[model samples]
Target: MSTSSPMRTVLVANRGEIAVRIIRSCRELGLRTVAVYSDADAGAPHVRMADEAVRIGPAPARSSYLDVDALLGAAKASGADTVHPGYGLLSEDAGFAEAVGAAGLTFVGPSPEVIARMGDKVAARAVADGCGVPLPPGTGTLTAGQAAEAAAGIGFPLVVKASFGGGGRGMRVVGSPAELDEAMAAAGREAGAAFGRSEVHLERYLQRPRHVEVQVLGDGHGTVVHLGDRDCSVQRRHQKLIEEAPAPGLTPELRSALSEAAVTLARTVGYVGAGTVEFLVLPGTSEFFFLEMNTRLQVEHGVTELVTGLDLVALQLRIAAGEPLPFTQDEVRISGHAIQARIAAEDPWADFRPAPGTVSTLELPLGPGIRNDFGLAAGGAVAPEYDSMFGKVLAHGADRDSARRRLVAALGELRVEGVPTTAPYLRTVLSSASFTEARHDTGSLERDWTPDPADRPGAPSGTAETVETPTVSSGTIRRVRIATDRGPVEVAVLGRAPRSGASASPSRRPGRESAAPGASGPGGAGAPPIAPMDATVVAVRVEPGQEIAAGEVVAVLEAMKMEMEIRSEVAGRVAEVLAVPGGPIAAGSPLISLT
Candidate 1:
């Protein structure tokens, strides 16, 4: 267990950017690495970086990333002695941790009991209270009358939260008697959807609870230490957008207290490896309340690593090997500052709707302090089946001010084409006054922000052009060409654009061409068929050996929480079903080849 002894081979049990991160750390530590991938991630950056790789399952997380038996089988087959489950997916699943340990492979995290205790928000609160940590005023599970009475005791403006969810999924603020039931029901529904539980608890909601979290590392030898704090208040829809270490605007006394609280919580849990203990710091008071503990590495752990100059993954591997605490409390140091922006594949203008597609071109930022944890290359598809995050851009400097300025500048020059992304929107946030000075909270995004009209893509600055309309859909598409001063061009309304007064017109358009039964149609046998928008295939209804009728749905796709039926274009026997449910196939991936 000594630091001098080394590990030979380790398997990264997850995919995407974090897997690549662990692989790099293993390389630095003189350890061979294995990468696991789903069908959708076969060509990902992490797979290419690893020394070896094995396919876990199909694209869906249940079959792939969260498949514990397959992952253990792989470690046994590959002769891997250790397995590292990065954040999300199976990282916090206590059963998965126990399985890895039972298989005699080191699970690079806390013990299974610790994972279980922390994974359950209700029990975690009990432990924190037992350890003398301050919890916001709240009540246990109660019926309608009891909930109302408890809310009265906790005062108005309290939050109802599900006992099993984190990252603010099952939490809702209720301020009045009329809204308590509705709010509680909504919170419970969200909890049930997110964590498979409808049980919820209530707590007093702090209006300006600054999102502050302490990073800590522990080992089985009963040693724990704090590595400073990060500010994660910049958020939208309860998701963090920007994170920075050495949280801006912290006094010496508060910082010390936060660090001590984090270390105390770890000691209470007998924790190990890298974990984050988050707190909701009330803005104008010294009273901070426990939010929840993340039992695995965090998405923003990179900022902490940048400032502390420690490879956290290496420490995790070392601890799992039963090494004694590497350093004393005083040995940890906080230096400089680091800022990270989550580059999401969402449309900022459309309520941050997930926009997933292929990347035609990508010009990511590059410089001394700019770091990109990207998972995609040019032409890689960002399918709608998974999370809408492409990656994060991390920048560090001598201080907070320098780091902020550099991150803003770097994002300005970065470009991602093809799919709609928040790259332009993030640049605007970086340059805004509130973000520049770090003078904001989680609600500031909804408060002081506005969409920049100029960031939207449209026409060029100076151009003399005939705007050609798009002709789309393999069905009847109407297009007409109109002559202008510039030249002759087409303006076809690819598919049917919605019109007013019930149902307006049919395959007839204004500018270019129209299939008016006799008029000429666009090239392509018929009109080149287009998938109805973008969506993930949830079920394929047709099989190769079965026949489909004209109106029958060949596949079902889900997008924006709506199920879309993909109907057959031609009535014939299905020759092939090119895509499977839960697989991330492109828009044109043939669902059924009809004869």
Candidate 2:
């Protein structure tokens, strides 16, 4: 009888890696999936993987994913019965959920009312307090004079938070009255940019606290289950770079207390579907303070799944379809330690800004206990229009030490050749004594640490002075063009899925972008990887089979964008031709190979 019922079809109103992650889960549960993308993402990995894809609008996220009409239109056109707002953008938008539900399509998340309530940090804290859950010592936002009074009562170190904040965007720490106003202004501006409204709240700031969160799953039937906890203290600029489940230093009693607090909050609101309740753990002290609730799936949910042996995305599907909570409290247990590191298309040396351009080489580590939640592929483009994260490298181990060591080894072997990524930076942090000993806090990344030689990619002599954006013309096809420091480089992509090995055989197809030739000659300088910034190969002195000594200059390339030369770090004979002149290239494409 159940088989006769109509099948489930979900329209994913988002793009990038999360879209791919969600689609994979929907597939395992026998659901047909539709993907919606902006003009910029027509060739994105997510679009190609879906059964059907619809162009919602232009490149900007607000005009597309956050656009209610566009999302609804795509769902209707694709015959979608549900809309899965995969984290960020419209994920927590109550209005979007209401719109989808009004259109008679299920929203694969919690109720609209629940989203609204959880969004207000003030209200969320109130609920936690009411339910006997311990909370931070700060009340709702008060008048400016009241704020000063409250600050005094809460003590000097306190946090001013935007009522609607995520990604640590609208938070300011004030240590004294002199810094309070400035913190407020910065918090308000950032909050407005990220969440639109700038309403603010207050909380006492605990120095050196560890950021921890619990994953909660609930069904409308009143049964809610907790999927352990994740330690998310490894950060830079308040953005998490590494996360792990079954936190390293937590005692059994502490874990139970934290998990119960998360479960209690869900039951308080009759919450439905997947959500995370975050808290700030005072490391030395066993006590923790309630931070806020994320009413949507988090970016780090994979760690929880690895430790608990549950497919959260699949669980979301079952819950959205009105299924009961599959397991009881006793049944849900953390089996092992799991760790995840975000591999972003950004330069850690450059204040962690997004490094957007073509991806010449895209490869990931594969083995036992490894899981990759990725977005980019070879020949795909990384745009400044969205986040820099290309994927997350996750590994599970029987214990914390094994997980950390295995994770570090996997990261060392991982490579993304096109744009600069945080892979090398991740390795540095993982091997550090502080991290290895499990001593970490929210401020660890910002603390002074000697930069490893490997961590620093030498400053270019020069590159990318003037940027030229390349364009391709085709009637009726809207395109996204990027102006690189180099000359205009045209990239035409197939948004539709390739026949599995299309990229591997790109050489046969020809005309795709390739980097300038590598440098050669004295000083044992061999240009190993060609820099992507626009420049001319002013000089290519190395030939095939040339014996190169260490630190020799193999090539001298000029990027009128900026003029620069690359030297090989390895000592060997030239093995192959990696780049060609008069062609565009990106960072890390092999220019020369040495024996």
lDDT of all predictions, in order shown? 0.72, 0.73
Please give the lDDT score at residue 124 for candidate 1: 85
Enumerate clash totals for all models, in the order shown: 14, 21
- Please give, for residues 1-595, the per-residue lDDT of candidate 1 as tens digits: 2346645779999877788889988888888889988888888888899989989889766677778898998888888989999887778878889999898888899999999898888788888898788888877765555788788889988889877646666677788888899677667765654545677888888786689999999988889988899999988756888899989887888888888888899998899889999988877567778888999999999999999988888888888877876678788888899999988776565446455667767788889888888778877767554667778899999999899888988888777775666767777888888887777887888767766545644322433222233445333333322221111112233334321111111121122111122111122222212233345566677778796665566665554332345565345777667656765444333455556
**Reference-based lDDT, residue 195, model 2:** 68
- Supply the TM-score for candidate 2: 0.76
Per-residue lDDT for 466 in model 2? 19
User: What is the lDDT for 441 in model 2?
Assistant: 89
Top lDDT: which candidate number? 2
Tell me the tens digit of each residue's lDDT in model 2 across 33-106: 99998988889889999999999988766788778999999999999998889887888888889999999999
Candidate 1, lDDT over the whole model: 0.72
Give the CA lDDT, 0 to 100, for residue 62 in model 2: 71
